[model samples]
Target: MTRRPEQFSLNLRPGNLRSRDPDARAARDFAARDFMDGGGAPALETGRTRLLVAGMVFALAFIVIGWRLVDIAAFSPGGEPRIAATPPAPAFESGRADIVDRNGVVLATSLPTASLYANPRQVRDPAGAAARLVRALPDLSRTEIRAKLSTDRGFIWLKRNLTPREQYRVNRLGIPGLYFEREERRFYPHGRLTAHSIGFTDVDNKGLAGVERSFDAVLRGRAEPLTLSLDLRVQHVLARELAAAMTEFAAIGAAGLVMDAATGEVLAMVSLPDFDPNRPGTAAPEARFNRASLGLYEMGSVFKIFTVAMALDEGVVTLDDGYDASKPIRIARFTINDFHAKNRWLSVPEIFMYSSNIGAARMAMDTGTAVQQAFLGRLGLTRPADIELAEVGRPMVPSPWREINTVTIAYGHGLAVSPVQMASAVVAVVNGGEFRPATLIKHAEGERPAGTRIMSRDTSLKMRRLLRLVVRRGTGRQADAEGYRVGGKTGTADKLIGGRYARDARIASFAAAFPINDPRYVIFVMVDEPKGIARTHGYATGGWVAAPIVRRVVERIGPILGVEPVRDGAHEDGGEELLVRAKARASKVATN
Candidate 1:
């Protein structure tokens, strides 16, 4: 069998048997011929087989990538399925109520802002990320930023109150682990103009001062905007005029308030050197102090209004009563002398017009301590004002109610009350003897609260006439508004420091009511530690310093508040007639 190989049969296993088909036979014959010709077999070479397989694999990969592109661009439309699309992160969970003026002008608001934060664990290159962040936020130190990023804390605030430019620059960095938290930041568009009344909020979106603190819970949860009684136009006028006065007098501090006498709503309250609520940390302590409601001072002769009103209300004196002011009265160790003394027997009208301390003391004696205390209590002077603000001051009244205390309080000394308290009391006397609680929030239509009656209607009318006469002919002559018939009393109290009154330190205040016939507005101005200027004739009295401020404020705000000026004779049927009759009777009695 081995002699002829081609014809011989070879034993083979089942897996090694060759096929007998024509195609297989032809392939085997061709392969044998090629091998005999010293050429490689047609089936495949070592490297070529690998090359062909790799080419097929590359084509398949291209087809797959193209299909995926089409699927992403056109096939799938609603949202990405392969990779989930992230949702926008929420900003502040708690929303704040809008603050608008009486005229619906936006005073304070919360605006959407992007604040930078970081997830320390997710940051790859903390040092590099911090450097880029610092470049974007100049206020942030590189070391501090790096330390915050490297910390173990899961989250940390990197920067707040970023500008749009800053946000864009930070986003461009594309640093890993850096993120933005949308937040609502409180903003005051009017800046320091309404600082005292509107107040400001803290970093946690909580109210910390002013009306913001008073109605915080109401503002945060409610959807309705908080409408305030403040009129932006009137507020601007008051602030502008007060700032001018503060600069002109070189005064250490200044305060002014405008209120609706009929409604007891504060229109504007200004305390000088006021800071923007948007940046409260930079404000001085004096600026944060609400002088209208927190700073109590013995408001000098303005107390004369209370004294005279009490005397009339108690029936201890009449408009026809006369007092002997022939000499300064010596009571115990205190001597009562008028700033401009009229050393003679003066009628009650004369006494008020001249601002005689002696005359005021005698009037208080007639009213008696019990009656005086009762009158003040009824007028809401013995307690803090019932307003929404947290910075109200309780009136400092003598505990013992001594004889000297009563006499001194009569002339605006030995008693301490806030300017707001004084203004509210004055409003009671002029607003038909009703004491309405002052309010910062706007009341609903037809929802007026009934006020307490503190004085008789007759006493109110009589006091209105007297207050008008004081502005027209007395030391408050500077407070006269040309057509408004502004009437008020001037007070100059020596400020108490370290338990003793400082002769050089003074708190000059003016309390005035406009359209004195039917009083509609009450304006109060106070200047603390005012220096006598050469232009002011070197006098720091309330009449010279604070009275002029009230005059300007009234002239500017009266028009804005819709208070039209009328001729003095127009009020003849109201309180002017009563004033004339009362003055005539006093003169006749004095002559007798």
Candidate 2:
């Protein structure tokens, strides 16, 4: 500048200046020497090189960082972490599928619902928020809700499955932390109408009983509705009639079902004292029982169908065969007698028509225990009923099936089976001797599963004639439907109470197959502990109680099922076939 300093620094001085201090003079001499050695330009170049190196180092560092970020985002494997600019968009999910009957009537379905939740930490005043929530949902406990709101949790469920009005009320309060999350709730449109069969779901939409529990996975995996073999109309008729019978007879409970004899498809099933599946928690435990498939009972004379079929199929007895049912067979403190006793020698047809227990027991003994056991197994009566229902009951067969057991079981006493199992076995007896497993799944039009042959076609035909004869002239006469040619047997078994039979507490039931000339449907109805009234002449027997139910159900459902009605003498089996053919077959067997 204006004047160059004599020394640039305290330790440096220009060579032209003379310093007084010795050290200063030495520093000036060294500075002059160094400047001369480097000529000053070299030192300036060194400093500029250092600055360039530093700039390049910083540039390299920034380049490496930028490249790493790009590689991660563009080339990283799916298993590795990748940086995302934003969260993914939500997807549209259709919840659980619907359940419908064969006619497309909705029985169960899922509906989109909003569930109330809250961020407890965001709640400004716990007491105040709970107070407002209680006003909207009175069912929610105020104390419990207040405690939940006071928690430090970031997320909490205040209430689940809120109604639209409830959600509105909560939203109107404008609570800061409260929010609504979308959810789906299972709904049973038919309610108690199909409670035991369609089943119910929990609050989280998980199936809990009946067909729902059995087909839970299929329901969640598919979007299309599930179709059942059940016909809603038939189900309604069966339930209505059963309920009326239950009321009229003052029965403790009732169960009934209608099965396609040829196909083994259950068209309708009903268990009285049923509950509303939509509000299952509010119903009594007894009301939720599935009696048709789960209740095991000694089905009295109904078992005679199987006994006679077994005897006929095994060639142990013929229609022309006779048994002495005049005297009661007293066996080891047990007596086998007929409810409608005819104290005389009776033919097989007469014994069946009269429901003679002594005759059935003698028939079973002639067939032997092992043969009876095998025969029942072939009919699918010695095992659990093969159905789609989750509540199916296993048959209670004697472990060491002895002569006494056989004798008692012949008349439907020692062995206990479910209504569904009995019906399925009866289907085999009347539907051309083929045993088809009962199923709830719908089949294609004109399609039916191949059944296992348990008896000969001839035996099946003979059995059909006998069933018609029973309805025409036996204890099941009341079960006959005009023009339907209903054929069945009546069963009245005393319920076992406290290890003893209670005469008053009886299981009255009837098993029938209609249009016996060409059987279409099989019907079974049971009333538990029915009290006899004046109308029944103080008789709570199967003929007086359950037979009427079968008749009414058949008359109403026959037309619905498209079964043509036949006039008397018009049906194929209207003649004396059982009498004429049995005599001829007996003569032929005797001649052989």
Best by lDDT: 2
**Model 2 TM-score on a 0 to 1 scale:** 0.77
**lDDT tens readout by residue for model 1, 511-567:** 999878788899888998888999878999899999998889888878777788885
Candidate 1 vs. true structure, TM-score? 0.78
Q: Residue by residue across 1-592, what tens digits does model 2's lDDT show?
A: 2122334555443543655877556666766776868778888789999999999999999999899889877886777546755787875455678999999999998877799999999999999989988988999999999999999999999887887888888889998999899988888888998999999888777888999999998998888899998999999999998999899989999999999998999999899899999899999989999999999999999899989989988999888886778899998888877889978767787777889999999999999999999999988888999999889998899989989999999999989999999999999999999999998888888998999999999998888888888888888889988768888999999999888999899999999998887799999999999999999899999999999999999999999989999866774654266656545654565476
Clashes of 1: 0
